[model samples]
Target: MIESARNLDALKRRLASLDRVVRTRHAHFPFGHAPLDRMLGGGLARGRVHEFFACEGGEAAATGLSLILARLAGPQATTLWLRPSAAARQGVPYGPGLTALGVDPAHLLIGVMQDEGMLLRAAVEALRSPALGALLLEIRGRAPQLDLTASRRLTLAAEQSGVTALLLRLDADPTASAADTRWRVGAAPSVPLPGNAPGMSAFDLTLLRHRGGRDGVAWRLIWDNERGLFGDGRDERDDHGRQGEGREGGAPLSRASLSFPAVRPAADRAA
Candidate 1:
């Protein structure tokens, strides 16, 4: 037993050394929102772990924003999304709706794990793969399994593989983790279209924590599905109802009275 323990320790040391040597330079992607992007020092860092926590009644907004980030992080690569089987009751990703959000549903691979343990294990493995451009782990509630150690493991894997990892926590509070950034997301009123129709997906995002930057900053972002980017919540409408130059300190939009469903059933034909 002592000999076996010694070998295990030696193996761990070797793995740690390998991890240090395999570090890849982290990259950043712009959110397209000038203020937010500037605050993020160009954009959010890639090849790092980021956490998004959903506020009450904002589960859908959190999920939507996370999905958008995943797509942006790996526009040309496949994204692996891991979730617990229990989340199926909430809803599945509607392919058509995802397409409407500028995310190619075909490039997204969803994995339904039996439990949180399995889901986290799969997330770590997925993050370690260089072929995967991004990984999203949807853990509803307080995920006890995703402790600091587990987060560190995922971060290390992402750093080595150059894959961005996103953690979406539904109905959960923030906890200790190795994530490079953390956010609180909620639904915001979207700018109405010409005929009072839904203009674009909007979100209220609060930067709860940033590893090497400022935090506690809040922004209202509008997701432009056509451009596949985000805009500052400025009412910049032209005569043709098109977006114009956004100015700072614009009037705040009214609170989102409309409900936006975050996830829809894949079986829903109406989607």
Candidate 2:
């Protein structure tokens, strides 16, 4: 059994190496924020997996970030989201919720897997599929199947298929991962509104790990779901729908507002 395991490990390493050498046209998935893009060395590279973790009471924030990225796949593109059966029992993604989050329900397919192993398997297969524009896997806690080796396998599949993969790790501590970037997300206090109404959701994001990039940088960002973009409370659009260029006093200055630029799907780009 030991020898067989060793052989399998070696085979996986070889496959990973081979996958790295396969030449494919990779495009940048920019966050539309100048400072964040600069920190990311332009932007998150496609054909790679990004890992996101949430602190206590921040599950919604982390999922929001992932969904924002998934929206970058464009309206016509297909996105696959996988979650464990346990998570499905508590919070299954529905069309209304996703629509409220600025994601088109028709473009997303949600899968509830029986266990971590099945979830990872489905994620890997979806990552390898050329038809999918993006893949998202959400896990609530630590799972043995999500170790470094398994992560590398998923990474290799993503690279080969040129599909973007996002892993949302909820209520978990940081650990070794093969993902290109890792972020820790926490809910931030929202701005107060008139009539004691609730304001937009905000998130405090920390760059925990990034391949070939600096870490420890943090930002408090607000998501404009209606616009399908992120904003830093700089200014509001005028009545004509044009955003004004001005910073708020005593407000945290966001480097730049993110604009949802059109990024063609991988197959379309390859064509």
Scored by lDDT, the top model is: 1
C-alpha local distance difference test of each model: 0.73, 0.66
Residue by residue across 1-271, what tens digits does model 1's lDDT show? Answer: 0011012234233223322223335479889887778888878898899999998988888888898899888875667777777776557776566766777776676776777887777777767666666888899887898999999999999887788999999989999999999999888766567678866777778888999898876766778777778873452322122223243444433433223444776465353
Clashing residue pairs for model 1: 60-262
TM-scores for all candidates: the values are: 0.80, 0.74
Estimate, for each residue in 1-271, the C-alpha lDDT of model 2 and write its tens digit.
0011012234233233322223235476766556677778767888898998988877777887787787764334666677777666564454444565677766666666777887787778667666666777888777777999999999999888888899999878878989999988776665554676556656677888889888766766666677765664442322122223232343434332222211222333322
Candidate 1 residue 150 Cα shift, in angstroms, is 0.7
- Stretches off by above 4 angstroms in model 2 are 1-26, 192-197, 232-271
Q: Which portions of model 1 show Cα errors greater than 4 Å?
A: 1-26, 232-262, 265-271
Model 2 residue 198 lDDT? 54
Question: Ten consecutive residues with minimal summed lDDT in candidate 2?
Answer: 1-10
Deviation (Å) of 220 in candidate 1: 0.2
**Which one wins on TM-score?**
1
